[model samples]
Target: MTETQTTAEAVTTTRPTLLEARDLHVEFSSRGRRARAVDGVNLAIGEGEIVALVGESGCGKTTLARTLLGLERPTSGEVRYDGNPLTYTSKALKTYRRQVQLVLQDPTGSLNPRHTVYEAVAEGPRIHGLPDEQDLVSKALSHAGLRPPDRFFLRYPHELSGGQRQRVVIAGALALNPKVLIADEPVASLDASVRGEILALLLRLRDELGLSALVVTHDLGLAWNIADRVAVMYLGRIVESGPVEQVLTAPRHPYTQALMSVLPESPERVVLTGEPPDPTRIPGGCRFHARCQVLASGKAAEAGVHTRCRTEPLPILPATPEAQAACYYAETTTP
Candidate 1:
């Protein structure tokens, strides 16, 4: 199918459940130590929603993306595309690969130094054996806001600025006419000014192309600005997730609140104590208890909180119809 036709078809069709991950567990084994990077992460992305996975470094956001893309195999749990289990050798995997593309944070590093911009964008369609490579590359470049697309076609990666390189990376992904786009810290490397521009580009692409996206970032401000929904990850688990406004305005999980409080204010700053616990040796009960001010505030301790926070695992329960948090106190506590 032509790129235009494929895009149009995706738009006209009722929004499909593009991706679903349930109880995903990814582990790394080394020298008698097993580290679970993603611990039972359950998430879904509809056809056109932009879901942001926000967390500190080493919280497994990148690992989750790799698992979803079939780059890394999960030790347990399932990743599905369009309701079927995703396997490396399955036909669905190839189809999913063609329909889902990723934009990495470091565009310069991600793009091959040897390949020109045109070659980079055309690579996806060429590898997938899609007909009409010329048209697809042209459309991709245009869609990515690289005006006079032909001007950039022959330029090497080193020739472009950081923002331009990122634009090229985005164009390469768009070339596939992907149904789902997973951007792993797409703006982390850019200048402050360019970050907004790239974010605006992503937003425009979502609106104009009707693309669903899973954006992984450590920046809550970025998530608040661009994501439709946000999932907060802590210690390899999703501690809280909900609509962007609800989660940001009134976070339920203590970890989420701590993260929100750390956002820079003009004159006031909220100090967070302690460091995130080691994933390899995760603390019992609530993984965040040591750093949670609320939990340390005598009230939680006096409420006869006997189980866990030091022993048992807590269930992720619904805080409201639209939101859920992996904390026993989420439903009862008002944030």
Candidate 2:
């Protein structure tokens, strides 16, 4: 492990939490039934920390990100900023929005084709009635790595490359001088060659501006490369969370292990047999039991973990002071 490797607990104790979600749950009416998109999630991002929220598609990572940004209201629970619960009233939300900006997955769809980079980046400041708009926009563009900002100011979205377009979107968010950024798959739509550049820009912004970020992505490799911590979500719940190295290099939860196993560079692959369970009708005990390899391996019974894996709801608790996993057999298994 490198010197940069720090435990989640250490980070928590040393730095202040900039944004947090406590016992958050989001549900929607689907086919006359309630579908839970986020269920009982507690997450915190400390100042200047880049925490990666990763899981497969539809695992509720994006939904959680939206809730944190106040874009989507939670069915239950509350979001806090600087240890105070958020107020979602129109004015309160507006002020909160200024402090926490969102970066969408698809920059092309998010940015208007007719709008020039200047207009896109200035929109937030204009809405908030902030003064010095032009100066702020120029600084934002520069901060996002679009040097000689005036050259790109009049360029339309369609006129720029994919990476440049994404930078413009980031510049728009930075224009607000937000303390936190909720980035939903920030590089998912860009070319592979440009992904590293975008990721580097995020790190630079965090280091230079003391910005904290909740990066919602499905790429484990991205987590390893840039994130200080990684939170693994499954069926609307966080199954495992800890420092990136601890969680990725030695995953405890069966679900997290399965995800890591599928990474192309992984030497051992653990292929799951079934699709993810339906969110509308989540399992009774462990939501992952239906697809968990550790539980079905017939070894858990010997390890004395069979009963809880089948009948008890496993809460996300500390497997160690710095790491957590919501699996009854996590400590017993070697995954």
Candidate 3:
């Protein structure tokens, strides 16, 4: 891959953090067993920065996103916004949610078929009792790239194309003038052809509005395409995190390497064997040891790190301005 400067590095690490998850943990009980949905996660999103939380389904990315949006309460730890810790009171949450909006995965399900574009976009401000409803709605549509904003005002979601409906969903969020956008699987529901447009639209909004976003997804390729930095999640923890170019170009963690190798662009393939991740029974040492290609293939033993991989649990590290990995054998991998 050609080297390219990341958005954060292009400027400096001095960018103010807009949203943060500090030592965050979330747990759920079912069948008398506890499932660790989020485990000691610490992530920071800088102002105007785009961070992709990449992981397979059930890796806790969605739950983490929900925590960041104040939808789900954390069992331990804290989520802070703009340097202030989040409070759970109804009034406080209401005020907090106003500045931080959530954009869901499927736009079709997100938009009510009954409401026209204007009504959908105006819903937030109306609920917040904001003035100038008409102006807010129109401006939101324009920002979302629906030209001749009035053209979409009276149109129903079903009347527009899939991409247009998603834009309407975005317009709804834009109407609130949110500083941070938490998009859960933003392009997962769109056709491949239209994904680029939506991704490009997000980039434009970040540049034009200084919008900081946390994009949750299972696709590494999408992260490489749109994010300034990437955080790889496994089981319920971040295994590796850094700039998009650094992580995607030369991933150090075996789990991350396995993911990268499966990309269509990768010349060699590394298939992992054994049971899929089970949060309830996450392994003793490395949560990923059971499925780690390096350990399974005896590379860890060759490098004299096999004992550590099987018996030593790695710490839940932070994901941030500096690149780091939680794996002890990360340096053993060829970069």
Task: Tell me the lDDT of model 2 at 145.
Answer: 94
- Residue 330 in candidate 3, Cα distance off native in Å: 0.9
The number of the candidate with the highest TM-score is 3
Q: With candidate 3 superimposed using the best TM-score fit, by how many Å does residue 33's alpha carbon deviate from the native? A: 1.2
Question: Mind giving the per-residue lDDT tens digits that candidate 1 earns over 29-104?
Answer: 8568888788777777877888999999998899999999988899877787876778777675678888788899
Give candidates' CA RMSD values in order: 7.1, 4.9, 5.2
Clashes of 3: 0
lDDT of 3 by residue, 138-236 (tens): 999999999899999899999998899899999999999999999999999999999999999999999999998999999999999999999999988
Native-referenced Cα lDDT, model 3: 0.87
User: lDDT tens digits, residues 146-182, model 2?
Assistant: 9999999999999999999999999999999999999
Q: Report how far residue 300 has shifted in candidate 2, in Å.
A: 1.4
Candidate 1, superposed: residue stretches over 4 Å from native: 1-16, 90-92, 266-270, 306-308, 317-321
Assess candidate 1 and give its TM-score to the true structure. Answer: 0.90
Query: By summed lDDT, which 10 consecutive residues of candidate 1 come out lowest?
Result: 2-11
- Residue 77, model 1: lDDT of 74
Task: Write out the backbone clash pairs for model 1.
Answer: 285-309, 285-310, 285-311, 286-309
